[model samples]
Target: MEFVMETKNINKYFHKPKEFHVLKNISFGVKKGEFTSIMGKSGSGKSTLLYILSTMDTDYTGQLYLNNDLVTGKSQRELSRIRNKNIGFVFQFHYLLSEFSVLENVMLPAKKLGEKSPAEIERNAQQKLDMLHIGHLAHQRASRISGGEKQRVAIARALINDPTILMGDEPTGNLDSQNSENVFNIFKKLKEEQGLSLLVVTHDEDFAKRTDRIVQLEDGEIIAQ
Candidate 1:
């Protein structure tokens, strides 16, 4: 299997004359299509570590590479393109555009990646929504859908890019138990069917434990891998 992401001696810190370290010498590699979870208590650096891994925050020490390419020194324009094309992100909040319909929400990323005719984009968006079992909600305003439906649309949007890797910072954070499980099941399906790597930051131990591999972090350092 291909290595989806790798880091060596990666460290992150917040400095203000006095340095405050948040991530301390962490290293790990994730394989393609593998599901891995990073777990820790509050302020254990779990979220901080995830941000560095996902290419969202890059101001850190040590080598951080995505798909074997060193991500340092890339221009903002270059990085933005990379992010749009190769990686997909789902945050704690379903950042759906309220003004757009469900189909439009899923098409936003694809539109940014490359320009396509509206008809074509809609076709693609519908296919992705169908995959997530939310095609019926395609015409509804995002604000009108339930939280679970909104999250499913977010997942569909992420998948529309056909990203090599998907990163989740508590993707199911706001959902109830049933909805959370449904979202997680979608993640599993993506890994099995699309060979997509996943690195999710979750406080839910039950969810973390279900992943194929677990990386435990505490005090900014990786305690176990």
Candidate 2:
């Protein structure tokens, strides 16, 4: 089956740190509409692998594919366009602009894409916020909301582009247990209700267990899947 995202013989190195090999022969696939998680302890290359997969770090050896199209060796401009059009990202921190309203934050990606008119983008952004149960907070300043609400707004922003896959790097690391569960449920809802593919890097064992599959990494190598 064609994967939403795939990597082959992927390897990465850190030059300034005395030529340290950060990732080793990593190969994996995230199927369409599948929910997958990557788990490892600190320094295990979990985040490193994620950055490579996300097309944000191109200094690696291997082939990367998104939506069954090879992305390896693409120019930076092409990769940037591909990333913006095909991938939605959420990080451990909700990096929303504090001064922007939640709606504006959610509309930013769609605006950058420039595929839809401003009015249409705003409508779509509001729809995403409503789907995440945060529509009521759309006009609120991002800085004024609770942490949980802000994270939800971040998720809404990620979904605004209607990406091929949603990727997260320890997306719930900053949340309390309840909020973490809420985020997990939101991911689950996206997968079940919208058939959205998701791949997230997380240290939480419980979170990994709940995903359809877990890719376990150790010492820069994929040890299990």
The best candidate by TM-score is: 2
lDDT, candidate 1, 142-184, per-residue tens: 9999999999998888877788888899988899999999988
lDDT of each: 0.88, 0.94
How many pairs of residues collide in each model? Answer: 0, 0
- Which window of ten consecutive residues has the lowest lDDT sum in model 2? 15-24
lDDT tens per residue, model 2, 1-225: 969999999999999949999999999999988999999999999988889898999999999999989999999999988999899999999999999999999999999889999999999999998988889998999999999999899999989989999999999999999999999999999999988999999989999899999999999999999
RMSD in order of candidates? 1.3, 0.7
Q: Which stretches of candidate 1 lie over 4 Å from their true place?
A: none
Q: Please identify model 2 stretches exceeding 4 Å from their true place.
A: none
Clashing pairs in 2: none
